[model samples]
Target: MPTLEVNFLGYRIKSPILVASGPASHDVKQIPIAQEMGAGGVVLKTVVSDKFDYMRYWPRPRYKLIDWDKKMNGKSQYFTLYSYEQAYSGSIEDYFKFVKISKSTSNIMIIGSAFADEPKDWIYLAKGIEEAGADAIELDISSPHKPGTMQFETHFIQAIKSVVENVKIPVLVKLAPGPDVLHQAKVCKELGADAVTLCNRLRGLEIDVESQKPILHGYYAGVGGPWAKYYNFKHVSEVYNEVGITISATSGVLNWIDALKYIMLGATTVQVLSAIIVNGWETIRQINEGILNFMIEKGIEDLEKIRGVAARNLVEPDLIVRWSGEKKSGPRNVFDDW
Candidate 1:
């Protein structure tokens, strides 16, 4: 079998398949299942400063699918997508118990996903996570569902800056893909973010025109799934080449092809959130199996070799060795050349 190991956010893992921060990773019970199911890493469900503040271990909310490409600027149709109206809420003490149980594995990364409403809250949570035996921290400053919930790159740099000053472990800031993506990542690095996860979610909504109502109960929510992959791919490519921080591409990544494309484009490792929701935890093994098969076919033994391989090709598009390319003029017979 081809070796599928990869280094992400300064830690080497058995594979590049990481479970993104979501309800799937909210408890210690899920962590072992994730590892047993062949996940390369697990970013723990986010822990907020408030423990038992609102609710405790709320059941993972269900997702509502809407046409992902309903408003695409061009030819694409039928985006596999959904909206999450619910967000997890737990107290600090419950999260600590979660961390303690997740630390049993020496290799699987137990990443503490966290956020805060104030600068002091950020610092306090960072210190707590460091002592909680978490391998690293995924600073989730980019959840689009709760608009004014937590202060991240755009709303409040000071909060992130506070956490950076307080933590010694690797910290990754999740951000949205936009013109300011590079700037956001740069700012994160400037404030001591070890790496940047390309996006949290794109704020979008699906509405029932016939019923004249919003499809989700939350009024609006972050859009995710395979449909978001193209935009994520472009954003990741731009950041990899333009910025110096390590990038973890998320959003819309569903298969090994999507994962491989992200690796070539400069993401050190990619994450799967919505795909996991749709496909279940077993998806990680399938992803690893596909990645290994591809690597073996290419006579490659490690996942690291393909990392950022695509970034170098962006400058010289004609120099690409395998995949065929055509100058995309517009919507006109784009597939005609194929």
Candidate 2:
């Protein structure tokens, strides 16, 4: 069998499929479930400091699924999710326990995730997570539901530098998607981040036109789904072409093919969330098997053969020649032309 192993941030992962930090990884017990389902790693839900408010308005954590058809019973080929779920509510100590226990019991990588109210709290939590025996630490600075988080963009490099300095394990930053993604990726590399997750959810809002109000507690929410894949792929490819930072592509993977597209665009691994939420953990094995089967059929021995191949050869848009052919004229009706 062709080897499916991949090297990510000095650690060897069994596969390039990792469960993203979200509801699939909200509980410690879910880690083993992900492992059993063939995931190579799991980023635990964002562990916030005690002072960070975890509560949401009544009827919070709501979701509206946009389907290909109006009836909403169609396939998820065009699925899109708009949601307003907050970060993890439990204390840091509780998350530490989860990481420690999960590391002991499962062979898959247990990446501890943290986001705090203050920059100092980030360092404190990073130290605690490293000590708890996590395989790596993911600094979640991209959560849209948390206000005042992205406002620290000016200090992001400094904050990431502090965590990288404090932690013994690899440090990765989960960045928000925007025009600044390439800039942020370069900054993270210069600041010593071992890897950069391409993005979290984009902040968006939906209107119930009849009610003349916003959906989900009448506030802007984070949005993602299958439709977002191409956008994420473009960013991943652009960042790889620019700085070549180790990238964990997230936000729009729904199947093995989607995962392959990200890998081709230079993603070290593809973190899946919306797919698992809709299809369950079995999708993990399905993705893995699909990749393995494709590799064997193509006589591909390793993922490196295809990673970033497309990005490396990408042509500049400005260099392309535009079509200037005259429009063809035809008779108004087929019978008249005959």
lDDT of each: 0.74, 0.85
Provide TM-scores for the models.
0.84, 0.91
* Candidate 1 Cα misplacement greater than 4 A, ranges: 51-62, 67-79, 85-87, 148-155, 316-338
For residues 1-338, write the lDDT of model 1, one tens digit per residue: 56777777667788777888887887667877888877778888777666324433332343665554464556234455655633346568677767777887535877887766777877878778888888788877777655455444445588777777888888888886665787888788888888898887877777788889976463666677676778877788878887888887888777788888998888877788777776688778888888888888899877667777887667556665543565455467748659
Residue 139 error, candidate 1, Å: 1.3
Looking at model 1, which ten-residue stretch has the lowest summed lDDT? 51-60
Best by lDDT: 2
lDDT of 2 at 263: 90
Q: Runs in model 2 with CA error above 4 Å?
A: 55-61, 68-74, 321-338
Candidate 1 lDDT score at position 211: 89
Q: Model 2 reaches what TM-score against the true structure? A: 0.91
